[model samples]
Target: MNKDLADIFGNLVNRIVSFAHLAFDGRIPEGGAPGETELRLAHDLEQRIKALHRHHTALEFRAGAATTRAIWDAANAYQQHTAPWTAIKSDPARAAVITRVGLNLVALCATLGWSIVPNLSERVLGAFGCNNAVPRWPTGPLLPLLNSGAGTPVARLGLPVEKISSEKVAHLTARFGA
Candidate 1:
């Protein structure tokens, strides 16, 4: 919306991207073990991601208020046409208000930047009972999203690929039995 609000959103996005890089690249300080690093990263990422999500929710509330005001302003100008529907299209003043609201929404999205991906990944993992485990990247349709232009920040982080030995895999299967 305003310059101040836009700046705040931009800062939040930058923080999110930085934390995501740490989590996804396995640069997060891990205490020990094979899956240990992944687990810790997932937990740290979840906390930061949730904070960013809360910020986004607050922005949405502000945006909704702006949109409601625009709609009300538009309603006052309704005349020859019907009631509520005509208010949206028939008034020039209302049209300007609507346009401003739309621009604000666009600005908000642009400022948030790369924060959406890892947050989404966390949700997907939760759906599978992974409980904040950082699943391997490129595991599904997410691969394309992570490789697309929209995924530039994600690609830049460069997740590590550890070659699991067959013996270790067998041991894991025997132990965890996944």
Candidate 2:
């Protein structure tokens, strides 16, 4: 069950941050600032996760399981519903938008998924330029770390993730439910 959620988040951070790294030609930004459209998408995602977090925090044993699943589901839905990558060649202006959204999405995941996978989330946050800060629950529209003074932006995103094996699937099927 743990691996099930980790795999979803791992794949999401890897793919999205990979795209964000390439979109800027490997140069992130001075203060890890992503573009406007990216920020908007990230803010929207944060809102969804925060909503789920509010609902699950009251439960004891299943406190974060539902929130983790919600984040996973939301990430998958975003990948399926939007093709931000299509803009690279078709519309140069749109490329920035895609990059911002992708990078910020990674940031959002880090903030919201900290409880589920703290170390992995920290890596994703580091890739986005937040080094020492912890993510606050019920996150607001703006990311404090991204806008603050911190780590240098890179041309290539460095997300450290471990892939989940197929054997983990059998263990997870029994646990996933609403």
Candidate 3:
């Protein structure tokens, strides 16, 4: 409803799109392979995701924007803290773990986001190699991972959005409550 909220959605879409594109694109550095740290991080992230799900469910029942705020905050935090780009080059192995966890995190968010924006969520799911149905929460390490080894290659994944337009920001901010 507001510019800050719009900014959050815009950023979440961008981050998810980037993760999937880079992973299946065969652009990852050779040294990166999913490992122990990844496992730990995945478990922690799963808990966070479940909590988000529960919160979302509760609000819809009691009858809210609560979940949106929580997810956007989580997505932004993960995006900032987990620098998959840097890890891919510096520590490929760690990068693998980092990227996977981050991707899964985004997948979880997208699944939750699907109901609100079916088209966008569908594209997000397809990118993650899913056909239909929201993926079960607390997914495994590789549940939604990009399988570069799968069949023939397709068109390279391009970014849906790079930055929010000033027009969009102004439009969104103006629509917010006075």
- Listed in order, each prediction's TM-score against the native is 0.20, 0.66, 0.60
Give stretches of model 1 more than 4 Å off: 26-178
Best by TM-score: 2
- Arrange candidates by TM-score, descending: 2, 3, 1
Per-residue lDDT tens digits for candidate 2, residues 1-178, read 3667776777776675676556655443332234564456557666766666666566543656666667666765665455556766776555554445445555666777776678877777776566766765544555443343222363343545565566665666657832
Model 3 weakest lDDT span, ten residues long: 146-155
Per-residue lDDT of model 1, residues 12-126, tens digit only: 3233334434432411212212233223333443343344456557776554434433322222221112221233356533423222222222222332222333443343233
For all candidates, what are the clash counts? 0, 5, 3
- Global lDDT of model 3: 0.55
Candidate 2 accuracy as TM-score: 0.66
CA lDDT of every candidate: 0.33, 0.59, 0.55
CA RMSD per model (angstroms): 22.9, 5.6, 5.0
Runs of candidate 2 with Cα error greater than 4 angstroms are 28-47, 59-63, 142-159, 164-178
Worst 10 residues of 2 by lDDT: 143-152
Shift of residue 143 alpha carbon in model 2, Å: 10
